[model samples]
Target: MGGSTPTFGFPRELRILSSREYRHVFDSACFKVHGKGLLALACPNDVGHVRVGLVFSKKNARRAVDRNLLKRLTRESIRLQQHRLPAVDIVVLSRRGVLELDRQTLARQLHGMWRRLEKDVKRAADAKTSA
Candidate 1:
């Protein structure tokens, strides 16, 4: 297996780690995408790569297993779609009903959310440049 493959790994730099980083994205989020099971917030970043943060709160899923499952689904979806996503900081917040959904359903929803968010980010970026 080659290490140069973009799809082969989810690197640390591509993740939104630390409370400060998460707070920055949340406080400065430029656009938001709301899906049935998730809410995605996007903020432009100069890092030249897409970064994602997942928030599966206790209120979203009471059980630890359910929270873990939702986080896994969110992370997997983001990892697979990282290339397609815009160069922005994105935070995905899982909603209460997410735990009851199947993996396929959740993946589809997350993918759709990313696609829409990407478009919004691109539009915002374009507008900023044009202005």
Candidate 2:
């Protein structure tokens, strides 16, 4: 164990716990990225790293298995891409037809959304610097 590998773990600090945190993002999201059946709303955070929350309602997923699958996919995607994301609190919402999508499709959609968010954050930063 001479060389250490970089870890990409989803710790509690990387999660958006509590209804109040979710509400804050829903109410004041500065960036929004929409995908096939997923939407990611994000707002800048002072914690200096990205945080994620999932909102997969029963009306959308319909079954506990389906909901858990969606959460797993979403969380895996976030864990892999968290290093590239800006310091923001992100809430990912699933639409009614999300379960219809295959796992690969859903993963691709999430990846695209994360890329869009990164671009948006960069654009905002450039604007602020130029101003």
Candidate 3:
């Protein structure tokens, strides 16, 4: 994590509640994309900042540790990219193949996902505004 907190992080009191929202970030919450392994839910924080959620399931990663590690990877990646994204909630789904990815590859993929998501969000906003 940066010396400064990423633009989006759940407040200490809200992290658990955020995960309980159930809606996927892409479909429900506003979002931006990064790489294959990384997806984010973006919603304006109450103070107009971003918040994040990480999802890793045993069905996808197999082991509890693997799932936990995947969540950790997602957290790190988002923390690194948080400054560039707007306020929104993000939920990263862990595909089965994610366990096969090395750390560096995962990080790279996360960055790419973020770039794609930014473009998608902008395009959607533009479309909505134009409509």
* Among all candidates shown, the one with the greatest lDDT: 2
List candidate 2 stretches off by more than 4 Å: 1-5
Give the lDDT of residue 109 in candidate 2: 96
lDDT tens string, model 3, 23-131? Answer: 5444466654545644555644454444566667777788898888787777777676766765555666776578788988987888788777767767777899999
Ranking by lDDT: 2, 1, 3
lDDT of each: 0.85, 0.94, 0.65
**Candidates' TM-scores?**
0.90, 0.95, 0.72
Best by TM-score: 2
Candidate 1 global CA lDDT score: 0.85
Candidate 1: tens digits of C-alpha lDDT, residues 15-124: 99999999999999998999887899888889998898988888988889888888877888888888888889989898767777788888888888888887887787
Regions of model 1 farther than 4 Å from truth: 1-5
Model 3 regions lying over 4 Å from their true place: 1-16, 24-47
TM-score of candidate 2 versus the correct structure, residues matched by position: 0.95
lDDT of 2 at 74: 95
